[model samples]
Target: MSAITAAEGNPQIEFWFEFASTYSYLAVMRIEAAAQAAGVDVVWKPFLLGPVFLSLGWNDSPFNIYPPKGRYMWRDLARLAARYGLPFRMPSQFPRNGLLAARVALVGVAEGWVAAFSRAAMLASFAEDRDIADDAVIGELLAALGLPAPEVLARAQAAENKQALRAQTERAAEIGLFGAPSFRVGEELFWGNDRLEDALAWARAGP
Candidate 1:
């Protein structure tokens, strides 16, 4: 049973991520390959930190509301990105609205392109410093993926899809998630870009 579980089990880890999150950008860039090499399946879970912040009595990204932490965050991201051989750039906008991107990512998850689309969205926002909030950016990303942007956008806006995203956010909260780039392996949770390997190891080791 243990061998079978390791070979054909459910998602070994649930990747809880938010687009506006800096650390999430790092994790997103590397998680797919790491998980594949570990022979662990991942469930990509997109969520909003807005509600989570509100629940904590904050109205915005803690990074912006607290400048010192924000400064450290940017510097830290630069160092980490360099170590990973990935590009990094500070966006003109901090925490750009990710609602549209998240919704489309939900579609990506269903259509089997969420990983690529998520990476592209992250690159647009962090590496290229583009405004992901704009529908045009997401449209271009969809078209690049050979998906019909208009139709995908339409489905993304459907009431059911909207509600599904909300439910995923709520689930994140229920799972005790407090930030992006969090990983859940069975009942164990690990957070931060630095913990990506740890999470994979834990998942690969099984419960």
Candidate 2:
């Protein structure tokens, strides 16, 4: 599965991402193509980093907590975005709440539209300055995908779906995940957008 297509018997890597993450935006935009090029399948994993931060005793994004780091991060992201030839725009908000978007993404993951939906959502969050947490915004995103917005929203809000997101977040912590855009090949975890290639190579080379 190169993000959307299920290619059985191919090497696979789990892409654990948080929608609020800056690097995740970049990775989501490119992962499908990269995975296809490497002949690897991608398992899209949408998770929340809020609980993960709490586990580290932090109440907010590390970027928000450390001004210096935040500054460097934005600059680096800009540079990389330029190098990658993707649009670069500083979002009006830092780390827009992505809980609802992630929930919808989980649904997309199951429905085989995860890659397309993820790219659209990431653009809304990082490029369009949309409030990802808003129900209206999510509905629009779904509608854009030709899906029944109301129905999908209701399903995403179901008790079981909410609980599933929570469980995935907990699993993130269980697997030693502290950040987004993480790639897991078997038990070997590679963190960062830059390590995506390494992760794909590892998968292509096998366990």
Candidate 3:
């Protein structure tokens, strides 16, 4: 009965996303419908990009650290967002603290609220240009999703959820995932929102 249960018996596509990544936002918005049409199920895996970057010796978001790439990313997100018929607005903070959001997403995955929470959080951060680090925003997102705000917030702050989220990020790095919106079918890594369709195709073909 869960959204992900639709993928049962079909290949499970692991979607690794970062909260602050613009391209990831685009992927979060459209991946479900595309995967459903293709007879695949999307496993929403929200991880922190900060740890991934730190593992590679970077201190900040590639967008802020690399001016040209950062500039191009914004424009690219605008175009993609428009194409997807989704609202587009850059968050006030370039790289919002995704720790809280990612933790909550981990809980959502277990509770069958992954897809909705992911979409809402992405919209709140990217389209509404809100600060995701604030507990208030995340609390609001949980409420909007009809999930128990206190329970979800407690899970996000709990030690177990924190560790689980960190492990997911570590696993992403082990699999050579350096960006948001990356997809994996088995061990193969497909990066970017543009690569999603191809990933689904690969899923259909069975690894």
What digit string (tens of lDDT, one per residue) describes model 3 on residues 1-207?
Answer: 766576467777999998888888889889999999998878889998888899888899888889999999889889888888999887888888878888988999899988888889889998888887889989998888778899889978999888999899889888898888899998888999999999999999954
Candidate ranking (lDDT, best to worst) = 2, 1, 3
Give the higher-lDDT candidate: 1 or 3.
1
Residues 23-44, candidate 2, lDDT per residue (tens digit)? 9999999899999999888999
Q: Which candidate is the best by lDDT?
A: 2
lDDT (Cα, tens digit) per residue for candidate 1, span 14-120: 89999999999999999999999887888899889999888988899999999999999999999999999999999999888888999999988898899999999
Query: What lDDT does candidate 2 reach at residue 180?
Result: 90
Cα-based RMSD of the predictions, in order?
2.7, 2.8, 2.5
Cα lDDT, all candidates: 0.91, 0.91, 0.88
> By TM-score, how accurate is candidate 1?
0.94
TM-score (C-alpha) between model 2 and the true structure: 0.94
Where in model 1 is the C-alpha error above 4 Å? 1-11
| Candidate 2 regions with alpha-carbon error over 4 angstroms | 1-8
lDDT of 3 at 85: 96
Q: Estimate each model's TM-score.
A: 0.94, 0.94, 0.94
